[model samples]
Target chain A: MEKKIRVLVAKPGLDGHDRGAKIVARALRDAGMEVIYTGLHQTAEMVVETAIQEDVDVVGLSLLSGAHMTLFVDVARLIKKKGLDDVLIIGGGIIPEEDISKLHKEGIAGVFGPGTPCEDIIKFIKENVKR
Target chain B: MKDIAKKVLSGDSRAIARLITLAENNDPSANDSMKDIHPHTGKAHVIGITGVMGSGKSTLIYELTRLYRKQGKTVGIIAIDPTSPFSGGALLGDRVRMMELTMDEGVFIRSMGTRGMLGGLASAVYDVVEILDASGKDVVIVETVGVGQAEVDIIKIADTTLVIIVPGLGDSIQTLKAGVMEIADIYVVNKADRAGVEQTVAEVESLVDITCSEKERKTPILSTIAKHGEGVKELIIEIENHEKYLKKTKEFETKRRLRYEAELIEIIRKRLMNFIFDEEQFKDKVELLIDQISKKQIDPHSAAEEILSKILK
Candidate 1:
């Protein structure tokens, strides 16, 4: 059987804003991927733990709390520290454009800023997922 | 693959998690890993928790897991949710409720999507349970989506099956009908703090009285406000008692044998389906047969016989 791509859509930090996370999760599901959405108030450690436990191919963190650099990097760092180098980490939800490149350097493969198409995120995952 | 199995046998959490995913996705490597890990299994008690939605199955699991942890026992939880048939995707929100357990070193919790499997379980659940067992968990819990009738497949996989019910649900008694009611090794009346607790318990007690034979062990009905940890300690003790009863009566061995029999059949069935459909010539032949059947040129049974004969030949 062909393996379905699995993604973990997480909201890291204290931001109660989960609309973007849910939307992206639904969109990914509609595009034929298995998405596990860890509801709001997830710590960076929690996201990484869930990613490892779920064995997801992608980890998409949605944070509107403006702690993107700290929270996203925290998740990325933990993912690497835990030897999950193959997991494609992505970020979305209210991240400033200036931090996108920095987020990439911190191991986020893709950053879906507001107004970016969900299709783009889906397409990117399909093209970039490691098996 | 051997290394992965070795890690799993050593209770390496990451390896256990990865292998479970492999099993869930039916990855080819999972077969070898499971084979290697199987010898170390059957040590953990498998518990199946099933109930209607809002029965607080997740909360109960969280509370139960905490209790087990307090006793210095490790736990593994597999929470199953429905996958959308249209997209083959699942939200798997059970983890949201049980997320606090994530930080615990002794507890490993995995969320599973039913993936269109009937009986309110993922097809890979049996294997996942084995993996957790081999990884040294003292208790392994399989929580199914709130299912209606005909979701009793959990009984085949669990050593102890817990059917949870909550008070004031109006149709709480309806869940006690035939297939669903008969599978419960233990019946839990959760949300005991709610109104009509006594009424709910009495209804279940009466149903149990009518359904079970006198020769059979009397199924116990226990109540709990799982969210507040009320009566959970007693629930766990009852779980232990049931486990002991199973062992004492040798039902444990019988159940294990039946589980293996079912598992072997499922494995063979999946392998045969994959083998038959994966061959291009056979697939094309089957497609032709499908067209023929659609056109009323051949019956499906006859077409199946024709294919079987070809395979046999």
Candidate 2:
């Protein structure tokens, strides 16, 4: 059997906006990947623990609470600190333009802002997933 | 691979996670480590929780695990969801309900897709159960994908199977039906605080009385609002009681023996399928036989015989 791409779609911080995260989860499932959704209000430690326990090929963080710089980076650094280097990291939600590069430098391989197509995120995972 | 089992025995989280993935993917290398871990299994009490969708199975498991943790029992949870037939993928959102336990060092939660297997479980669930058992979880909880009458496969793997039901889905007649209703060692009426709770409990109670007349012990029916952690401690006690009953009746050893028989058959079945269809040596010959059968020159049984003959030879 071919290895299925496994991704974790997590909403970090105090974000109750899970519509975007659920949409991405559904889109990833439609794209033939196993997506574990941790739902809203997850701390970075929770997300990293989920990623580790899941042994996912990718981690997708969706934060619409405008706490991207602090929250997304916290998740990225925590995931990295846990040595999940092979797991691809991506982001989505209502982030402004400037922080995209900052997120990348923090180890987020892709960031899809509002109105960004789920297809692009799916494709990006298929392309950049290290495992 | 032996080292992997060693690490797993020490509860190395990463190694345990990787071994589960390898088992899920059906990689050949996992077999050796599985063999190494075999003796360490059969220590954990395997609990199977099943229900219809949105019946609070996940929340019930969360509450159960919390209670178990309060007693210092380590838990390993495998939550199964269906894989999309068309897309061959799945959304394993059971973790959402289990987020609170994610950071707990004693709790290990893994979600799995059914991967085309039916019976409310993933094909690799049997392996994952053994892996977790060997990893030192005192309680191994398996939450099946929400199921109907026929997904009673949980009985085969679980030492104690709880069939969860909510109010308002159906009435007394639902419990009278066969397959699922008869398989529950315990019937949990979750969301018990909802309206119609009394009727649902009465329905299940009457069914248990009627059906268990021929049995040694009557199946217990309990009510709970899993969302609020109501009645969970009582539920856990009932579970442990069931385990003790099995042991007292010497049914525990008998049940384990029966379970191993089923496991052995399944392993043989899977190996035979892979050998006949996937082995490179017989690949072309099997295809030719299939072509012949499709053209009505041969029957499927005879083709199977031909393959088995080659295997046996």
Candidate 3:
């Protein structure tokens, strides 16, 4: 059987609210991907480490605590540092429009903010995933 | 390439992870890699933890992993969840319980969806176990999705099988009568802090006594409040004892042989299915036969024989 798109939906930093993360994780799952959810309060290194062990094609970092800039870049850089160039890094949550551009510059493949449809995220992943 | 297999044999986490994916996909290159990995395996002890949903199996696994880490043994965890049949998706939430170990270099956790495989394990789990073993993990744990009756495939994979139960679950023994309890090498009464711990333990002990009273090796029943780490030390001791018993009796070799036989059969079945179905002409022939059968023009048995004859030819 063909390998299903494997995704790690990680909640980074001290934020405890995981409703958004869980919702997106479910959406990705319903879209036919295998989602490994690292529940609340994860560090950047933990996220990267999990992504490596999971061999996921995409790392979906969901943050609502406004630390998306640091946490997102930290995960992205760590993935790169580990020579995981093929893993696509995407971010979602309350990330502001301005930070999306910064995150994009920092190697984030895409960003989905509040109200972005899950299908769009799923489409983005299917199209851009290195596989 | 040989380099991927070499890296995995040398305990490179990246290569280990990547090779698992390749094996899951049934890529031919992974078969070559497995040839290299097979020799380096058989070192780590493989354990299977299974129970009903909400039985705290994940929490127990987290505690067990921590204990092994304290003993200076590297650990690998394969947490399996069921795939949604309708959507072909799965929410593997076991990682939540073991998140504390995520940063520990000595611990590697991989969550897998069953991918619609049968018997409560992912089809790729055999390879994953070998990959982790070859990667130098001292212990590899396979956690099955909260399974109901008859998910005993874990028995084929684990050297030690821990069947987890919890208190206050209403006639826990009656629930265990469903054939799921027979596969336990060790019974763990988790959530022992809850009411009726003694009752549950007694029930399991009586069952074990009744079932194995004549056997030389009796199944030990242990209790644990996995949430607070209470009784986990005793549980670990019991597990290690079981490991020693398996070695002493040479049952470890028997279990490994069973695991390999199951894996070999699964691989051959999958390859045969892919080979027969991948040919466009064969697929079209099957489709035509299905159409005729639906229209009652051809019997299903005849269609099957026709296809069989082609393959035989």
Clashes of each: 0, 0, 0
Error of 2 at B138 (Å): 0.8
Candidate 2, B164-220: lDDT as tens digits: 989898867778888888899999999988999999999998998898989998999
Give i-RMS (Å) per prediction. Answer: 1.3, 0.9, 1.0
Pairs clashing in candidate 2?
none
Evaluation by DockQ, superior candidate among 1 and 3: 3
* Model 1 chain B weakest lDDT span, ten residues long: B169-178
lDDT tens string, model 1, A1-131?
A: 65888899998899998888888888998888888877888888888888878888999999888999888999999999989978999989887778889999999999988888899999999999986
Residue-level lDDT of model 3, residues B1-313, one tens digit each, is 4999999888888898889999987788798999988988899999999999989999999998999989999999999999998998888889889889988989888888887787999988999999999999999999999988789899989999999988776675574575678999999989887888898888888888888989989999988889899889998899999999999997989999999999998888787777667778688888889999999999999998998899888
- Models ranked on TM-score: 1, 3, 2
Q: Per-residue lDDT for B134-242 in model 1, tens only?
A: 9999999999998876788888899999999888766645756678777899999999988999999988888878777574688899999988999999999999999
TM-score of chain A, all candidates: 0.97, 0.97, 0.97
Off by over 4 Å in 1: B169-176
lDDT digits (tens) for residues A37-124 of candidate 2: 8888888998888888999999899887789999989999988888888988899888888988999999999999888888888878
Which regions of candidate 2 are displaced past 4 Å? B281-306
Runs in model 3 deviating more than 4 A are B170-178, B296-303
Consecutive 10-residue window with the lowest summed lDDT within model 3 chain A? A93-102
How far residue B243's Cα lies from its native spot in candidate 3, in Å, is 1.4
